[model samples]
Target: MAGGIEKLTALKVARLSKPGRYGDGKGLCLQITKTGVKSWVFRFERDGKERLMGLGPLHTVSLADAREKARVARASLIEGIDPLAKRHEAVASNKAEQASNLDFDTCVRLYIASREAEWKNPKHRQQWENSLKMHVSPHFGAIHARRIDTPLVLKALEPIWKTKTETASRIRERIERVLSWATTRGYREGDNPARWNGHLEELLSKPSKLKKVQHHPALPFAEIGDFFKAVKAEKGVGARALEFTILTACRTGEVLGALWHEVDLENRQWTIPPERMKASRPHRIPLVAATVALLKQQVGQDPTFVFPGAKQGKSISNMAMLMVLRRMKRDDLTVHGFRSTFRDWAAECTDYPSEMAELSLAHTVGTAVENAYRRSDLFERRRQLMQDWATWCSTPGVKPKTPIGSAEEVVS
Candidate 1:
């Protein structure tokens, strides 16, 4: 005992089993809870009120360390500062720091959501999710965004870098974007670990050097008429959609996502909205008589979609045309390959200007400067081109003469 106060010794603290606070000299004490949990506390009075500050567990903090901490708390109280308030502020600051640090997967989702509106195609968002889930998520998803260093990103990319170069490149770009987003949002700091230009270029081979470009398998232009006939013989929304796709030389997604409102049967034109276009620009397709008749037949069946799916209020599956091809036993051909077939036929059989053929396919033609000077979409000339195409497609085994004039002269 010192100054009529019992000093808590290490031996006494270890032997004490009662659930009460046992005092030591200078306001330090050992607290034993009802559950037999033992911890150190620094007891003091400030502004005429007694306050107890938890130093730490008895097992972790030695008796000497607790006494030193008590001396510091007592000093703070003498200086008119509440030790409990100071401790609380420190704890809150640490919690705030932890709360601000987002994990990699969470950062990925936030980054995607922020840029969703800028993405032209709905599939682009899906592609981001699929790529990140397969490549980045398994390795670094749980790690704090700030802690994602170069080695971790390299580990995620190295396996796929050689085997799936294009996919690996896309994943690396996405990870870089997420990390950049985190840095800008204050969730992380430092140069992005996934940066490619000067940093990752040294680590991985150039994408161009590693990539082997593969084109879609297309049916020969001469065989398209026979294929069109086979598709026309089938019955269903998908069949009609497929036949319409061939007639217009449009992509599968374009035809399947078609809405009735976009069709102007009297004018013989179908105007695809900018959002639906692959180029992110509105496209006007000149429909021939055959296409107009097909639209008329499909009109009253569904009030919304030109090609309704099995589910209500939805467009047909993107796979619908492929399934039709499968049924026709043409497993080698893809629905998108028809556009290539159309391009081949225009080049080989017609005197149409190359620009018209490209425009009919809704492809962006010319450089930005050239496009700036060009104003017209040449809708009337395209109408004639499509009508001639319909005539050729309907009459199999017939070779047609060259058109009288070039597309530019015809349009003028």
Candidate 2:
């Protein structure tokens, strides 16, 4: 059998199927499982340890093909190289090449998909998709993500930077994020080309300089009492929710997403969990008499939501309160303007501390150091303030308890 090599032939390999490894000599073997599934394996040694490398299934890799593969592996072993390690290196290189070649459009899809779950709403995710499609995609989306450079980013942003400053700024931030994601995933490398600070800032004008600041139009604090009375007279769940929102001075999202379990009717409190809040901190609102009555009215309407939408098992839509304002022919006023209305009323009408008003609005008050030491939510003082607010909203022509010149020093 030629010095114990080439001991098995093609017919011998086909017939030797008794559930064990049969050698074809030169360390190449045909292995048959208990169920008669067969494949070729190459046995070798490197650094005093034994290894087996799979060739292919016996059905596809004939004895001749197996022998050729084994011969190449043996030659590698003789030359002080491990065939298995070399094969692994080749595979890794191929994968890295594939990763580096991923185009910008594909990277955007992957990046957005990865972050879709963390986003607040479908509209937010849609904004990411739409902005990139309209602005960035036309310029460099088909280019390899790794190959994206400063000029490419500039090409996408420059035309819109002045004419549509706010939109351009958002696109820049999003592009920076996608490139950063690509770098983390090994699809791209080098400093992010879309970065603003100390990078793109050198090329583009400051966003704040280009865009005008626009605040939501608010109803004058003096007119809020009449507005509240008009809103209370309106019929529907939205009107009730709007009434509650104004009295509590809450964000539209916070009011709409409220669940029955979050409300404590007996205690006159509504506890909004951190996840639902924009500041990501737990907020406790003291429910005044007006707010408690509003919650009571909503009880029989939905099993879960305090303000249920028309859809089964869903909360009220984000636009519901705004629609109520529009129906009242007050299209000039935004739902969020109510918070500013409350702030103005608290400053002009009440003797309560400014920090109390800020806290009631669920806004972060004072410096980080100040906040760290200030543990109190000032719930008791806040309760009294909210009661006074409710009284003001309910009673027409209520004058400021504090004189204009005698107003207490406001602490931010």
Candidate 3:
């Protein structure tokens, strides 16, 4: 029967029994608990076994929708699918749609959160904020994901694509990423408007010419040992952080915001929490003996931070290291350029594996599946690499001919 609303109201409220059908159908069991709570259930066969799906309160789905739902359930069964599986699939699809309907702001925030360790370049972070502010938020920041289309994304990109091509290109990529997330969840469908394959490239300028790549200026690798010698002549937490940052090959912010808790001095390691890392995974940095010495020397300090700011519990200001460089009359050198500096040294001076060098910089390995299988963080390989780095800094131009220690023994 096509149970109408009137018939729905006329149907008696079925009382619950002990985990058995209530005469309606096989899975359509009503269980009235000993405590008087009433709930509905549907059961069906799939993969040679039985399964149950819950339909809500008697007051909620109502007898009418319940019957209507039951019909859909039976129809699915006739097609050799389990009604319970179908119900869950439908719910998952709906949840995916809800996630897709998430606005541009929501998705990008997620995207940024996702890029925790990957976006080590300071400019990468700046462009994320700048692109959203200058291009995206101006137009579609508040709009829901389902409503986004080529025209809207083009509007976001067209104005600055020619003039600020670099940032514009990155903005488009981020927008595409957000829409792709939306599309996967069912908020939007069809080709991503932000995508620039054969479909989109015709409408816009070539992204390469439009985009300008920015590089952080680092002192030459030949100058690194001298740079550290100069760094030691400086004062305060900023100097210590610079020394540590150069030694570990981490970013400036990672060094500045260093909390005491993250440091495992006894283990000679620093574990950066996922929330603090650019890649959003907790990463371990094996501290060289020199770096450990710096920490222990400053242990009795008031600020719990490895580099405390003027305010309590706050990180040292961004300018702290910059000003340190300027005071040393090396204003031309940047705090961030030190990473490239380390990379250059590892490449030119050492026989370290390329992957080990990259990990020292906290860069991602590859696809998620690849990362899952590569369990080792190559700590021992890096320990020797870092100790070699310290020895290099301990001298001016003399390259060390041999590896420092068995990579594992450095832990002691």
Q: What does candidate 3 score on TM?
A: 0.63
Per-model TM against the reference = 0.79, 0.76, 0.63
Tell me model 2's lDDT, rounded to 2 decimals: 0.89
Return the top candidate by TM-score. 1
**Model 2 clash number:** 0
Error of 3 at 312 (Å): 0.9
- Residue 324, model 1, lDDT: 90
Steric overlap count per candidate: 0, 0, 10
| Residue-level lDDT tens digits of model 3 in 241-350 | 88988999998878877889898888899999886788777888988889999889878675477777788868889899888888888777789998998888888776
Instruction: TM-score for candidate 1, please give it.
Output: 0.79
lDDT of 3: 0.77
Clashing pairs in 2: none
- List runs of model 1 lying over 4 Å from the truth: 1-68, 75-89, 119-126, 207-211, 366-375, 400-404
Sort order, TM-score high to low: 1, 2, 3
Clashing pairs in 1: none
Better of 2 and 3 by TM-score: 2
Model 1: per-residue lDDT, tens digit, 1-412?
Answer: 6594557777988999999999887888899999999999888887788888899998899888888898899898888889999999999999999987899999989999999998878888899998898888999999999999999999999999999998898899899999999999999988988999889999989988988777888888777777777788998988999889988999888898899999998888999999988888899999889999898889877789998988889989988888998998989988898889888988888788888989999999999999999999988988888887777677666655654346566656
